[model samples]
Target: MSSFNRFRAAGPSSLMASAHPGGDSPALRAVRTLRDAASQPRMMIAQPFGPQGERPESDPARAFGANKPHPTAGWIPPTALAALINGLRRWIRLRALKIIDEIAERRMIDRTRTLDSSRHVSDHLLEQLPVPVWVEDESGRLVHHNRAFRALFRREAEALIGRSVAELLPETSDSIPVETRLDTGERRLDVIIGRCRLTLPASSPDFRSIAPVGGRIGTITDITERKEIERRLRELATTDDLTGALSRRAFFAAVEQEAERSSRYGSKMSLMMIDLDHFKQVNDRFGHAAGDRALKLAAQAMVEGLRDIDALGRMGGEEFAVLLPQTSLSGAIEVAERLRKSVAAIAIPVDPHPMTVQLTVSIGVAERLDDESDFDRVLSRADAALYRAKDEGRDRVVFDQPRHRDIFPA
Candidate 1:
């Protein structure tokens, strides 16, 4: 029989099956792989890999194509070769695209997870902050608050979030938005009696320079105790520690201001200079402790007898001054007489002495003239009147004018 007829009778599959009957054999598997890789379904053909344009001596294709009249055993018809080449190109293109897509998908997933992890860590840090911290959106709605903020305002996350930032903060926080617009980047420290609210400028991103920041982070510092200390310090500077009255410097400053007002507006204002009668004797006989008690008693009495608009200040030892706003000369004399009687009525008991010590005050009264804006002049006039009262007698009220003594029987 002719070679072509013989090869046709023994098909390629039968030849492969007869040589390697076992389906799982390595050679059978290699042959199957080559066949599947070289062609699409319904067009599959077995083709052996070999040298360029030539079949290797041991190539399986030799037996199949050997009978062909073509001189080269590796030769394939143009149509079948084109089908095989096109199939390989299509498979490579589709597989490469699929691999590229898988790589891109994995990268995107990793990026998303990384961002989520970073967000969680940052949120935990904000939650653990010591100072009251808050986050708000551009609409001024509260987004998040730290534990400190919740404790200070006594609100839960559910209650605060999505609400207006204005509602979460005190009315004093209004300045924050206004000042934020100024964008000077200065701290705004608003202190109330029990609560001091501090908003840090740099940390908070409220609207743009022209807008309130919708998602802004800010801190609120509690300075209530600090504010209270400052207020006490201010009081210590301007007030007398011993007598609870205005100190000499503070009293003069106040009088100077009032004197200017009196001169400009032609308002009535008066002053009094008082010297405790026989104060030296009391200090000598009862000791300084007893003298302090006497002084405290006298101050308490004067404070109780004076009007709210009046001010009392200790000039020095055994001497005191009074500022009476909106008072005339006659009015000043009446107040001085009343104070004298009140001081005279104070009876301090000394333990060792076992006796009630009686004291009196000599007062000098002066009225601020319409044209005189200098309070030092008014103070000098009151001092001179005080000397006259001391010269004439110990326990009487005298004025800067002549024959202005008034006495009451006790």
Candidate 2:
């Protein structure tokens, strides 16, 4: 074959071809000469020394002695190529598995972080709430309660969780009508439940019922103290400070009510007007302080002398009025006499020397004759009788006698 054809067929597969043209060719002689020139003395295989100038076993490519590689064949070894392909496949599969495992691990870590974050935020929110909040599930069992609810009942949040609303509150709380608005602390709270309902805002849906999800949520506050404060404020507005009794305005209002009641029920009522005798002299001698003390002492004596059903009031400076419900004229007179004696016998403490002074009061009693006799007419009659008592003596009780004329001129 021509050199061109041989070269083309050989390509990269003939790089290790033999150099010999023929057994005795000149090219073979040149190759042999080159090998002889490069040869060196060395130990023989499994022998202490060369027996007869033999070549060493540790020479390059001595695997098959004197053997030449065939041309037009692949360069790679058959066994080595098989192992290399297997190694490559194994590396590729290992890399793919590593990548898949890394992705799965990252997803797991992310889910764990999300769960932790959600729990942390929920705990933080539960602790910060102020009002007591409880949530129950559809089965009327508690799902959760805020820190405020736990603190209010002096219990732990965990303890209240998974409990029923009935377990936490009394039966009265459960009986409340749903959708019915009610107030707890003077104002109404919006509540919705199986029985009770209020119109108010809730921080959580649980607050509206014992369980929010078909269960209910509940909250409680005490309003009795606030209501009592308002009631006392109203009472103070119409009370006299000196004697701790009703002022004139309150007295008239009460008497009007009593008058109406008496008229409606056909029950008799008596009114008495009282005046402290020599009050001005007491003020002039021992100062107004003594007069004030005398008034207090007289009030105490009158309060002690009358029944609890009777209403007594200070009718402005040194004068007092009384309303006796369900009393006849004779009974009114007896009550007035007792009040007069009680006031007359009271010893008042005065200033400077701290001297005790015995004082007296004049009383005039009047009874309602019929339904037509109103507060005004009763007061007028009592006033007329009061003047008569004062005219008769400084310290005495007098009954209403319209027929009796004033001792002095009008």
- Every model's TM-score: 0.65, 0.57
lDDT of 1 by residue, 43-111 (tens): 323453545655676765576564235431232345544554554455467668889999999999999
lDDT of 2: 0.69
Clashes of each: 8, 16
What tens digits encode model 2's per-residue C-alpha lDDT throughout 85-180?
Answer: 554455467668889999999999999999899988976886687766666666767677777767655777677766764575544442322332
Against the true structure, what is every candidate's RMSD? 10.7, 18.1
Estimate the TM-score for candidate 2.
0.57
Candidate 1: Cα lDDT at 288: 90
The 0-to-1 C-alpha lDDT of every candidate, in the order given, reads 0.74, 0.69
